[model samples]
Target: MRVDTVGAVFDALADPNRRTLIGFLAQRDTATATELAAELPLTRQGIAKHLATLKEAGLVRRRRSGRETRYKLTPEPMTDAIAWMATVGGQWDDRLEALRSHLARGEH
Candidate 1:
């Protein structure tokens, strides 16, 4: 997984509205901005803006059908991000375990 891709995913996910949008998309598989707006507290235009941010982060993909555009969550980028986080978390766990062992031995 690319570092930039992970960064983009994190940045896109930092917004609560965007995270909620992701959850909605995940549940529905695919939906249009108008549909999301109706379900969410935001307006259609607001939903569009959030979707655009998701698209830029590679977290979602858009398709046009007739006159309306539908958005779907793209899990690949998020998968990459999750994998990266797991790796980092593992390293931290290892370090903390080592510190615990050292402290047990009274070696600071």
Candidate 2:
């Protein structure tokens, strides 16, 4: 994925409401906007808006069931997200180890 695409995924997760929705859908296979709104403080419309943003970022998918629309998590982008974090994590770990080694030398 492009850097812009990866940035969008992280931006989508930056919101607490969006994060909660992701976690909820991750637990279940899928859920309707109405179902999710009932659990959160926002209205159903608000949830729909969040879903729209998530869908745009390729994090969530929507499907029609008769008159209702259901949303579900897409793991592909999520996996990419984990990979980005691991990349950053490896860099941080290396820096920390070097810092520790430098500090140990000072203590000796």
Reference-based lDDT, each prediction: 0.97, 0.90
- Model 2, 25-90: lDDT tens digits are 988888999999888899999999999999999999999999999898988887887888899899
How high is each candidate's TM-score? 0.97, 0.84
RMSD of each: 0.7, 2.2
**Which run of 10 residues does model 2 get worst, by summed lDDT?**
1-10
Q: How far in Å is the alpha carbon of 33 misplaced in model 2?
A: 1.0
Worst 10 residues of 1 by lDDT: 21-30
Point out where model 1 deviates above 4 Å. none
| Model 1 CA lDDT for position 99 | 96
Best by TM-score: 1
lDDT of 1 by residue, 1-108 (tens): 899999999999999999999999999978999999999999999999999999999999999999999999999999999999999999999999999999999996
**Model 1 deviation from native, Cα RMSD in Å:** 0.7
